[model samples]
Target: MNSANGSAWDDWDDEVDLLVFGAGAAGMTAALIAHHEGLNVLVCEKTAAVGGITSTSGGTTWVPGTQLSVDAGVPDSVDDARRFLQSVVGARGGDAAREAFLQSGPLAIDELQRISDVKFVAAAAHPDYVTGPGAAFGGRALAPLPFDARVLGKDFARVRPPRKEFMGLGGMMVNRNDLGALLSPFASVGNLKRTLEVVGRYCVDRLSYPRGTQLVMGNALAARLYYSLRKRDVPVRFDAPLVELIREQGRVTGAVAGSADGSRRRIRARLGVVLATGGLTRHPVLRKQLFPVAAQPLSLSPDTHTGDGIASALAAAARLEDGGDSPGLWMPCSIRRAPDGNDHVWPHIILDRAKPGLIAVNSRGERFVNESNSYHDFVMGMLRDAGDGQSVPAHLIVDAAFIRDYGLGLLMPGRSRARIAEFERSGYLVKGDTLEQLASKLGVDAAGLARTVQAYNRDAAAGKDPAFNRGASPMSRFNGDPAQKPNPCIRPLGDGPYYAVTVWPADLACSAGLSGTANGEVLDANGAVIPGLFACGNDLASIFRGTYPGPGTTLGPAIVFGWRIAKFVAGKLDQAPAGERSRATACANQPS
Candidate 1:
């Protein structure tokens, strides 16, 4: 039904050597690599801007065995990372694609550094989210260096700004170091100087740009990749969305794309068409089928990720990987309404959840999960806690000291207790003079909450969390307040006044996608390759089998597989033989 194998009709509006269907990190990286390898490339973005979900992410790419890891003194290797993934994901997919990712991840990063402006630095102490035989303390995760969007000049408009709630001072973007100075500008002379410089630059940028030109995190990663492609003159069409693939003579040829003004064009691809259109998270039918009913209508991914690429691939007879333990990567988010009538979903990601003096509880007012755990695990715990039919959203209970020290979801740290009045009025923040009062306001069991707090405070004072073991892992401690004594993630809530923000589970990215070969070719249901078609990014099934191994689990495989797809199309990649693929898959399926 998807392939058009009738009489050949070649009335193309435009043609290129490679047609990339998304402008996200994966698509941009693929387009850049292909252009450098002598292919004329075109990147089509569904939205009017670049940086699909990547612009709002942390932009950390997890690639092991790189020279940067060695230079940073992190003793990590590909073998260790493999073991880590195997333990977390089990025998899913037999890990054929995962093994390919391990072999090429470091090489992909090195090639990007050598051929493009894409730069990354290994974090010295960013521990893995879980501790085990293959886990390393650091070096496997690489953060993209901040970039100046001013370098793009007018082209800066093409880059999507981060989520509105994430920006400070209206539209000013702040890096981690710059934010520290901005928050405590009056604390020290150095902080004041840095704040002044940062603010001054942002003010100047606001005159010409809609947001601050100083980009960091995922925005920086997207900007750097976009700029590199711009330098190479690779044309990226804004507002052009792929409609369907053009198949002729038993091979996928090009596509029918829709334009901004609602016109469609028949475009041709000489070499190949790479499907990297985010994922199927927003697809109405697929989302209902893949996500939990509780997770409906609340996804952190871009709205453009409506499964267009995957749907088109399915029509082309591509098979999908079935039955992943976790169909989508998750985050615990607290939402707030903006003046523009849009809801702001603030992801509780390594911000305040792991700090001391904070606790998350269910409808019964009982702690169900370790508040200091990774966001994914925390959300998984939330879903598991719902087995008893509590219908109520999870509540994170904190106090005045917690707000001033670590802040709640959208609340900034070091803010005064008085600053919470506006939030309380908006119903985003709940307050009570006592634990009983707070329980009433939050619809929680009053006596159960009091008992939980009494026991929690006593244990916290002794620097332990026996109930849920909050700070027992390397990840929990790494993201916790290092200043806290004994156990950095443990602390008792003070007397009297209490506050809370409701937490809901949200999907950050979809892992279920089209099944493909290690060489990046789209495979049909019968295990036959679809000529001239390939997939990457969220469009390709996750190598981790929907398991969250660590930071950049999604982007790492996205870039590696995308690069390999381009190389394979260029006839420069060495495809794994049938026997080798079988043996590798079998071995990876063995017990950890």
Candidate 2:
């Protein structure tokens, strides 16, 4: 099945030393690093454009012990990162993988910066997700390349702008504080000035040289990597999606890719194939298999991440190993369909507990989970709710204050407000002139909700969150109103004209896939390695197991693993002993 085994390149064929399957952040980073190492590289993207969800995401890369932290005057240590990872992953965290990630992260950043015109700024305020036990308050997360999109020449037109719900350009990195500033209303002159400053910077970038500078975190990252690869004359093909991987004796040799224009091409890799084609949240069958929840779809990840690469690896693995227990999933997230028909996902429990006037309740109209806890815990509560036959449609309760303060329901200025009212009238949003009335409207016992609110206020007044033990981390502060003394996020919802937006538990892209060692070597279910095949990003099981350790942890691991794969292919790690080989009985044996 290995189409890449022989030199099938005819006169019209182009050849390169490396072939990268995705041009998103992870693939782009890997391609840039390899290209910087003086290796010829080719990046083929399924999308007509490069920069996958990374362009749409808050472009932050979390890495411990980096120059960004040191230079920014924030302090962090490797020990802190290790302790945090261990606490989050328990015994499942591997020392080699952790070490590889930490050690290679900064080096990867530096190497890429040296070869490309990329710039990075530190997100000093972006604290570790949990600063309580073994986590640091600073220096772990780094922002995306601080780029002025004016440099991309004609490539700028292809960039996606940052969604207004969050601040920062495609490449401009910001943390919770920045997010707060964006979400906050024009209540202060300082905020207005800050907003103007950001806008002015973009205006300047637009007027300076380029006619259309599509500047954002994603575009900036893409431009830097794409330009760097192009500078080395690396071949890039767009709308080309890999269909299958060819293997010989348990080693992948090449891939068969079909282009959007109905052209098929065979690309053979001499070194190896990197499977970064993303996870299966976008695949309906995979979503049903993985989530098993009826009628609910995930919304956090792009629609393109359907675990195609993972499926391919699983197929190859089935031929290599038998009865492999698919890795467990880290199930979190709450999603509502966007007005544009896409899922609008946020760490719901986190956002509600962090932001005021938002609380999640089960169909019985009672609060079930710790509203202020991490996303994983919140999703677990929803899962439990689903099992109980209780329509755990999470209801986001807010008022005019919330609407005036922050953009609601993913609708921004110039966007239609019809969806918000539609959901409300359709019973998805419960609104009333009083708290009890709103609760009554939503099918919850009015007294129960009222009691819950009273209890929450008492906790807020005491500056203590006894229910969820929130306020322990800085992340929750963004959810509260600073003017509210004691507990900022714990205000009572007894105000007049209360509103409730039903929140539904939605999936983010699946965080589980082909099991691989820390070295990124694709391993069978029996812990055996498949030579010349590697996977990273959403294509492999996350190092954090089922929990998101912090922001940028995903991208951090991607960069490290991508770098590790490149180096391993170049024979840089002699310590990486090839493991035993085993095949799967069928690709279907792997997890959904």
Candidate 3:
């Protein structure tokens, strides 16, 4: 084999049955499945860390019809799942990709749990993001069981930590179930015991490690997959990025990768190559092309995701899907500069908006959205109301009571007076002594804000919202604080020391990318499959198009298609001639 630059290269540097381009959930799943099928696998990651955005995510998978859900007494069927997707997606890209996802998602979850340490539990109370035609109040979303990161030994450092804003007590990770205990540590004896147990574990783990080892959410999911890979002795190379896709007769067979020192090597993959390099959210040019508006610098995804995989696939003549209504999944994020002068982003997933006593208002100090809706829908409201960027930075208004109970972005509840003073002094939170003062501080019309609050308080007293119907839907109430009576998402913004935070439109994941078939094979401009090449994760065009169906829609399809590609490659390798198999084995055994 000779290099493209005409350099003499008679032998390959490395070879494997399958070469995976990214180390996120999709690529790791593919590598693990391939290794289990008696095939040699290699994973190359562009960043210094292994997990992509998946490590920083919620780590929930919206896979229906799983044994976990069945055991939890949640009734879910494939037909129902299909109907749910169809109702949300609605003839966007046909039903083939959605059908593939529904059939393979449960099987992928079951097989991974059987073969590896990956375990999942059903989130029985989590509702679908929308209360559409086929929405399920329960039995869809599954989160990874909490994992002990100490099992990874020294390799734990390779797992990217969760977002700083998502962590608590310095660098300790907490799940949804743990938040209640921590919030009301002195509420009951059991609560106190649970809080002490969690804090004690974190305190002990922090003595020897930079962060706690009690991993949850996306970090747990990524660690589980990485642990399975290490157990199978799969080799993963960090700081190695794909430079080119090697092809033979228009079929992608291998890749050229570059090292940190600018050195290059050719690695032949006899079976196939999988692209799972997150998505195109961070690519400035691509973001401009795909997004409805010019994207902001802030994103919920890790900064390492720069659309390299999407670019490579496009250069190989892969087609990008542009028929979706929106090209990316959105979330409202608040940014605050740390002492180190770097911007820290806090994604508003489940914190302040849905809780009672908070409302989102535009520049005119007018309420624009039902703040209790999902993050995606909330941001869509922002975009729709954004007339020439007026709503780009929407204001979330809350009162002293709300801030004391629920807290605002980056501002935890039950803070001491000193801590509140620090946040206000640092300009992370804007506080005013009255509604008119708060409106002035937020640069909105004081009269408009006062009128809005007056009407809202009257409705809250009556237990109904005539405007926007804040708590009318199942999803709205699902995210709302159940402790609040009447409407969980509606309350009067009363008292002094009102606060406001500026939120910008940020994408959690892109809903559009390379077009691919149901089998995960990349498709060209004419919708023809590009043999020996496949994409999964955010690298592949989303099955739901631009619509968000549920909590784990992105990750669910990613895991399933990753599994699908591995199975497809294994079958292809089995049908290859003996000589080709021998060459692949010989090449795989060669030393770097």
lDDT of the candidates, in the order given: 0.85, 0.62, 0.83
Q: Candidate 1 residues 1-592, lDDT tens each?
A: 2345533545678888789999999999889989988888988889988999989888988888788898788867999988887787777764777888888888899999999999999988888887777987799899999899889999998998898888988998787767778888998999999999999998998889888998989999999999999999999998999899988765677888899999987778877789999989998988888877776758899877899999999988889874387778899999887666778789999878999999998888899889988888888888776666452379999988898877898888787646788788778889999999999999999998999999999999999999998889888999899999999999999987999999888888888888888867788899877877889999988877767878888888888888887776665666653432322222212332
Segments of candidate 3 deviating more than 4 angstroms? 1-10, 572-592
**TM-score head-to-head 2 vs 3, winner:** 3
| lDDT: worst 10-residue window of model 3 | 575-584
In terms of TM-score, how similar is model 2 to the real structure?
0.83
How do these models rank on lDDT, best leading?
A: 1, 3, 2
- Total clashing pairs for each candidate: 0, 27, 0
Query: TM-score per candidate, in order?
Result: 0.95, 0.83, 0.94
Choose the strongest candidate by lDDT: 1
Clashes of 2: 27
Residue-level lDDT for 345 in candidate 2 = 48
Candidate that beats the other on TM-score, 1 or 3, i.e. the better one:
1
Candidate 1, residue 390: how far the Cα is off, in Å: 2.6
